[model samples]
Target: MQINVNLNGTEQSHDVEPRLLLVHYIRDVAGETGTHWGCDTSNCGACVVWLDDVPVKSCTVLAVMADKHRVTTIEGLAVGGVLDPVQQGFMECHGLQCGFCTPGMMMTARWLLDHNPNPSELEIREALSGQLCRCTGYHNIVKSVQWAAAHPATVGAST
Candidate 1:
């Protein structure tokens, strides 16, 4: 099957198997490696990417399902050269330890902030509950989202 996806603001078209996973398409065909492929069962949020502005586990979604849709990977989180507030928040708060779950966490955090600019700590925790980070105790991750909430900016990045 042939699939066309607006990936990170760039249009990408490729021929792949009907059952090819979106994660493989993004990495293998689209040549974007920022979106990690982990826990094929979708237990790990490592493969999370935004499809038409809504975050979805890429491993659980077929590439064909993303046809004609917008997909935003971690590579697209920055605008021009300015990092999204979520990215900045992660760095400023030391949110990441091993850096495996950073992308999904950041993506989910960005969505949360875009929807609720001033999410409380509990709200932040709840929003990121799906993503699992084995390295950190999630303290700094929550702080990172909170930092993003407090430091909202006009990051020309697309969701």
Candidate 2:
């Protein structure tokens, strides 16, 4: 199938198998490797991406299902070569240890923040419950979200 996708503010078209996962299409065809595949199942939330501003597990979504939709990965969060608020939060708070689940976590957090700019700590924890990190870095990850909420300027306040 030929899929037309708007990714990271750019339009792209690619011919791929209907069964190809959106994660694979983003990584292989779109050349966006920032989105990782930690677990094939949607439960992991490691392959999360924003489809038209809503977070979805890319590994479980078919590439054809994303046709004509805007897909935003971790790479898309940056603006003017600057890290997004979530990205800056992760970096400043040391939210990542192994960095494997950072992208997915960031995408999900971004979505949450978009809806609720001032999420409480409990809300942050609830938002991140779906994503698992073996390194047990949840402490800093939650702190990062809190920091992002407090310092929205660094994240550009556009989100």
Candidate 3:
């Protein structure tokens, strides 16, 4: 099957098998490997990406399902060489240890902040419940999201 998608702000068309996962299409066809494929069962949020501005686990979504939709991978969070505030927050708060779950965590955080600019700590934890980070103990991840919330202007303006 041939599918067209707006990927990370770029329009792309590719021929893919009906069974191909969106994560595979993003990594192989779109040539963007930032959206990591992990825990194929969707238990790990490592493969999360924005589908038409909402976050979805790419491993659970087929490429054909994403046809004609907008997909934003980790690579799309930046603009003109400036990192999104969430990215900066992660760095400043030491939100990641292994880095495997960083992309999905950031994507989910971005979506949360987009809808709720001032999420409470409990709300942040609830929003991140779906994503598992074996490292960092999640304290810093919550802080990172808090930092991003505190500095919403940077990310909102860029996006």
Model 1 segments more than 4 A misplaced:
none
Of the candidates numbered 1 and 3, which has the greater lDDT value?
Answer: 3
For each candidate, the alpha-carbon lDDT, in order, equals 0.89, 0.89, 0.91
Candidate 1: worst 10 consecutive residues by lDDT? Answer: 150-159
Model 2: per-residue lDDT, tens digit, 1-159? 999999988999999999999999999999999999878988888899988888899999999999999999988888888888888889899999999999999998988888899999999999999999889999999999998888777563245
Model 1 per-residue lDDT tens digits across residues 12-73: 88999998999999999989999988889988898999999999999999999999999999
lDDT of 3 by residue, 101-133 (tens): 999999999999988989999999999999989
How do all models score by TM-score? 0.96, 0.96, 0.96
Better of 1 and 2 by TM-score: 1
| Candidate 3: residue 103 Cα off by (Å) | 0.2
Give the clash count for model 2. 1
Clash pairs (backbone) in predicted model 1 = none
Instruction: Return model 1's CA RMSD, one decimal.
Output: 1.1
For model 2, give the RMSD to the true fold. 1.3
